[model samples]
Target: MAKNKLEISYEIDFELVAINASVKEYKLAWMLNKSLAWNLVKRENIELDFTGNKALLISNYLYETEYQTFRLIRNRAVDGEEQFNAFIIPELKNFDYFIMLENESVGFDLNAFISKIKEIPFVQFAVLMDAAALKSKDNLIF
Candidate 1:
């Protein structure tokens, strides 16, 4: 039988290195990219809440799930915190996804985000990201 693919999404804000690393080092951004890809290979449609990377808030269909995979890509860094409301609002405009992460950002109003995310018509799952997965899935993802 064919393996069914699930759509997985995450909110990887500032802790790219720590979030992505089994053992964290320098080059947090780079480590995050590597770690994210490594973690999501089992899925098909992957939406990344890049509000952590400062890339931009945009969605694209990635045919190549191996080397290039992303649906919603936005970065919280470099993008300025002021624009956070705009960025996050748009992510919820079209899709309902679980906001995945190890923990919440310090300055961020996590409670506000949670309330807003849940209110979004498209957001079906707003959660602590990988909090549950790590406890049950693997030792490395935590």
Candidate 2:
């Protein structure tokens, strides 16, 4: 039996209340990337944030199996972009599924999302899956 590889991305925009409320795009991207690190093996939640102000990414395969590995590196913006290029590079030789979700409380277009995302050469499969629903599926087995 072969395992399925899935990668989900999400971003929550909270009203930053600070004297300056300064947030670099890299930090926000790193935070969302942190959300994707789900490990059933370690039974642990590790949030690894990058150390930079620019849009930088570190693609790490924390959970790997013979069939597949979940690789996700994200940089979030109002739109599906960043000044610096953020890539989700899979470092394995296997047929896999890639799921990308961008749920902003503001601007997002379904047609545009699918068209551009599917066009990416490296992406074998890509689409938006609801974050809440995915969380439920992660817990329940049928």
Candidate 3:
């Protein structure tokens, strides 16, 4: 008798940009909206619960069009009790925020977008990141 095997794989079909800026999350989102003409609106906070009752509340801003979706998320979550910072992607803690773009069309240019983001006065720098290379990339699915 022969047995069938099944394997599951997830495809990360989005573009990730790591942004390093000293401004607040809402201010950064507003800057992006003003600079790029993107209508990123404030959305409900994303809550992630971990073991030992650890929880993280991350701020997210979203902009959606017919062909694409954009999310600007803050990277660090401040702990009220301990006065510490917890990062979304622990390996990339240096980045203050992350911008995720999910495009259903092929016309979107990531390099050009990054360049434009770098031009913003509030943005210190922005760089494209490979999602598949991160160990905690699964945290981005939300």
Candidate that would win on lDDT? 3
- Per-residue lDDT tens digits for candidate 2, residues 41-109, read 221222323347543333222334444333332222122243344222222112132232322334545
Tens-place lDDT digits, model 1, residues 1-142: 8999987655333211111112211232233334444332222222334436533332212213333322222222123343343332332333222223334334656566455434434334444443333332221121
Q: Residue 29 lDDT in model 3?
A: 87
Give residue 55's error in model 3 in angstroms.
0.8
Cα lDDT of all candidates, in order?
0.31, 0.32, 0.87
TM-score each candidate.
0.26, 0.27, 0.88
Question: Candidate 1 — which residues are off by over 4 angstroms?
Answer: 1-97, 102-104, 129-134, 137-142
Per TM-score, the best of the predicted structures is 3
Q: Candidate 2: where are CA atoms >4 Å away?
A: 1-107, 136-142
Error of 3 at 22 (Å): 0.4
Worst 10 residues of 2 by lDDT: 12-21
